[model samples]
Structure formats: structure tokens, C-alpha cells
Target: MPLYKTLDPNSQTHVKIWKITETYEDLLQPLSLKPESLERVSGMKSELHQRGFLSVRHLLRAFGYTDLDLYYDEMGKPHLKDGMHISITHSFTFAAVAISDVEVGIDIEKQRDKIAVIAHKFIDYEFDYLNKYADDYIRNLTVIWCVKESLYKLFATPGMLFREHFFVIPFTLEDEETISWIDYKGQKCRFNASFLEFEGFTCAFTLPS
Candidate 1:
């Protein structure tokens, strides 16, 4: 198995990343999926997406769980039958998961120049510190996007707008970590955000501070 990276941010949390190098058939060989999961994978039109789905199952197996032990909530957030909090993410050639005793969220995104084009869509207050001409602009933007996305998954609240509600504290690419908040509907919660880049992709994950 191509388990690319494993991290224990805390004693109670586990993060696993998989470099997706296996064919869909090879990825499917070692696992059994729930009927719903099987159906969901079957309906995915892209073979890459199917492989990402299967790779997630492999991650679950690394955590000593199986597809049968997982389910999605009304908000489409993933949960474990044993009650541990879980979050999932996959992009291009990678897939990852974060599970913790406390609520957590994870996101992996391919670093792309296109993120700069749509930066306004998810960024508002953050614009104050972002320099579009900086050498690390794309990396910084990817981290911000991933931070907001992970916060969204953690909140799992409907109608949350990334630009309006999610805010990531400013940090340089060298910092590799920052703080973020969700300010929505008179409620505010803080989280610790951390990120790393590998093979042209950026991965960020958050846990309640």
C-alpha cells in the first residue's frame, strides 16, 4: 500500500494520506464496501474519482474500521459508528482522512494558478494580507482555501458562506500553521489550522483548539 504520510497531531487524532498509484481494480481488491458505498462508487463517472473513493476505504482500514462502520449525516459529514469524529478529503493524486476524539476536519487541494482567479469568491477579510504578486501567492491562497474548506466540514452547517463567515488569520508560507475562526449567526468558534505541501498539492486540516 502506498501510504504516503501518517501524522499524530495529538495523542487522540490520526491523519493518514495516501498517494493514489493503484489501478481502480487493484484498489478494490482488498476491501468490501457497503451496498450504498458500492453504489456510490459505481455511479462516479470518472475512474479517478472511483479510485479516490476506494483509497479512502483503505485509509479507514488503516484506522481499524471498515466501510460498514461509517455513515454520513444529513449535512453530508462523515461519522464513525464507534463515535469518533472523522473527516475525509481527496484531490487529484491524493486522498486523506483525519479522525479524532474531538471534532476535526481535513482538506487536500491541488495547488493551481486558477485559485487566484476565484480568490474573491472565498476570500474577503483575508485580502488585506495577501499579496497577489508575491512568490508564494499561489501557495498562500491554496492554504486559505483549504483552511476554509476544512472549517466548513468541521462546522457542517448549512448555508455557511466561505467569504462571509470563515476567516483565517494571516500567516506566511513558512509558518506552516495558523489560527482560524467561524463567525456565523452570532456564534464564533476557534480552530488550529496546519498545512503542508507535497508533490504540487497542499493539504490542510483543523481541530478545535
Candidate 2:
């Protein structure tokens, strides 16, 4: 089994992580999917994206959810039949999902140096805190990118320009974990975020505070 790190904090949020691996297909065999759902996903060009959904669905099934129990809203945000908050994401090889009684969001990304070239597009206020040294730039960019992506998924609102609004507090890249706040439309939402380095990929997730 892939390692699952679960944090059931006493402080109003619960989180868990399942690292994606080559065995993702095997793990998905137990999930029963409807023909309609397959037809819907079949149009996606990336086989990786399709498998990511399969892995996510398997995890939800293990948590006692059936295929038809999950639905997406008009904005393409997911909703649970039982009314639980849900968020999902998949990178090149990993897929992640977060569920909470309170609203939640999660994101995973493969660490890549290319993010630095486009940092100015998705990052603004976070730049001041990032290490400008070439060796540290990519890792720093990855963390900030992951943080913003998580916030985007959490808010599930269109027209969210990352550079214009998202801001990550200053912290050492070596810390591996941090707590941050997001200012969205006058609401200051607290987030607890952490980074994991595995198999040359980096992933991060946040839950409401």
C-alpha cells in the first residue's frame, strides 16, 4: 500500500494523503464505475488525467462512497451526496483528494524548474520572501505554486488570478510545513499547508483552519 499520512488535528480540520504510484491501476480495480462516467471521461486527451480520476474514485470508494454519490456543480466543483466538502487534484503521476465536514481544498504538483520562468505570472507578493539564489529558486517556486493552486481549488471560483490576490507568508523552504492565511474578498481564511518530496515530485495540500 502507498503510504497514507493522516492528520486528525484537534483544531477543527482533518486531512489525509495517499501517495500515487505505478500500482494506481491495481488499486482502482475494486471501484465500480458506471458506463456514463466512463463516456464522460473518455473525451480527455491525457490518459494520465483519466487514470488520476480512477485513483481518486477508488480512494473515495474505500471511504464508503459509490460512483453515483459524487456530483459536480455548475462551476465544475465537486459535491458529495452526503454533504461533505471535497477537493481533488492530480499531477503527472499522482492524484489527491481531500474531504472534510468544513470546506476544504488540496493540490499536488511535480516539482519542475520551469515554474521559475513563469513565476511572475502566478506569483507576486510571494517573491519578496523567496530565495533569489538560482539553486533555491525552483523549490521555492514549486511551494508557492502548490499553495496558490490549493487555494484556487478551495475557492472554486472562476477569474481567480493568482498573482493579483494570493500571498504566502514568509518561511524557510527547509521547514517542510507551514501555516498560512489567504485573503479572498475580504475574508481571511486560514490554511495549514505542507510539502512532501517523493519520487522526484513535490505535492502540497491545505485544509481550512
**Candidate 2 local distance difference test against the native:** 0.73
Which segments of model 2 are wrong by more than 4 Å? Answer: 1-29
Clashes of 1: 0
Worst 10 residues of 2 by lDDT: 7-16
Write down the lDDT of every candidate, Cα atoms only: 0.95, 0.73
Error of 2 at 33 (Å): 1.5
Top candidate (lDDT): 1
Q: After superposition, how far is residue 31 of candidate 2 from its true place, in Å?
A: 2.3
Compared with the true structure, what per-residue lDDT tens digits does model 2 show for residues 94-145? 7667777877777778888788789899987887877778687787788888
lDDT of 1 by residue, 84-166 (tens): 99999999889999999999999999999999999999999999999999989999999999999999999899899999999
Question: Cα lDDT for residue 88, model 1?
Answer: 98
